[model samples]
Target: MGTGPAPGRERFLAGAAEVGLQVDVVARAAAGSLAEAASLLGISPADIVKSLVVKHKDGTFLFALIPGDRQISWPKLRALVGVNKLSLPPADVALDATGYERGTITPLGSTHPWPVYADAAITGKRISMGAGAHGYSAFVDADALTAALRAVVADISDPN
Candidate 1:
């Protein structure tokens, strides 16, 4: 109702700061796709990091930080997480798990602080990712962001 940071934005800023990481929050218009969002941010689509939330059969969650031009490799992700079954939870389930809606989900300020798995391509690059809100994103040093989240970087994504 009020014009302020989104639900998890404030906490994300605090947490990033505590870890000596600087993240720049950018306001954007609602975008219908990754390419559109990239255009709005004046960056290449590859620079966008998509924080996709996935659920395991055991009821746990994980954040897959894939590049905008890629898609998660189910085999790689499952093997990395040591799970045979994983699923993309519904919007409500995702919000309940991470305290952010589907399109606005980020691992930065998640209510549950779930484990983050990032694509190796994102390392040592500047990336823009959801900032726990729709029409908003954060630009950050990939290494710092991954380190702050203690994310496991691996070849878990495929070219989309």
Candidate 2:
């Protein structure tokens, strides 16, 4: 674990352990967005899995994992989620729901166990994801990650 008392990191690690998933945390100096973080890590953005929080018209929150090199397709996501409308939640609302800020939101360690939907295009043996803290990310086997997070794989991403 990196320095600082990031509750998100704590919760994420705990969840990973609970699911018996081994993960490696890579700490960097300072990087905000997925592009910056990928650059700092010297890896392609496609290897970075970004956790996105989407809210339905009924105010229900869901998690979507998309490759950093791609973007979420709003129409496809709404249809997959069976919602009339879907939009990003406010920063504070996202943090309240996931226990992490915008730049460090992880599907794991959420305040509530929200459903996780992963893009089918993100196929790889391993991948990196935010560790519920900025400047930190976790590398884990893709299968282990999806299994641990209980993510549903779907085609909900638009190629970059």
Candidate 3:
């Protein structure tokens, strides 16, 4: 399933709407970094959320929503999720787990509906994240996203 084409923009927007969120779609260039993405979206690096797929030793998967200015702290995340071993899955595994490509993965409309773990700093802020497609991003209230996804918010990141 991961080898197939990823979903389109409408799917992401529709998924957000289904959860009562109205996000603004921001155009992005392919393979852009957080800085580039923020620049393109007219926001700050801290305002960009990165949607990552992580796996546990027991095969449980999670969506780690980290801010662009920070990197996920493996130790912090392990402690938060009560797991000793956690790793970022390969691109195919990520796509299979989230139904989105590497550069365009989000938890909003995932095929597996994995649990979401967001950094606490994202609370009460506006952020940009991948929108289930390449070359596009979604801008929305981080609080709304956390509420909708029932995200476990914690300090699971460190300055990049």
Identify the leading candidate in terms of TM-score. 1
* Per-residue lDDT of candidate 1, residues 1-160 (tens digit): 3665555677667667777889999889999988999999999999999999999999999999999999999999999999899999998999899888877788876888889999999998999998877778899999999898899999999999
Clashing pairs in 3: none
lDDT of 3 by residue, 19-115 (tens): 8987998666765477877887788999989999999899879999999999999999999988789999999988888778887888887888789
Clashes of 2: 0
TM-score of each: 0.93, 0.91, 0.92
Q: What is the lDDT of residue 111 in candidate 2?
A: 83
Q: Clashes in model 1: which pairs?
A: none
- The residue-level lDDT of candidate 2 at 90 comes to 88
On TM-score, the stronger of 2 and 3 is 3
lDDT of each: 0.88, 0.84, 0.86
Candidate closer to the true structure by TM-score (higher is better), 1 or 2: 1
> Relative to the unseen true structure, what is the C-alpha lDDT of residue 113 in candidate 3, on a scale of 0 to 100?
78
Give the least accurate 10-residue stretch of model 2, judged by summed lDDT.
1-10
Name the better of 1 and 3 by lDDT.
1
Give the residue spans of candidate 1 off by over 4 A: 1-5
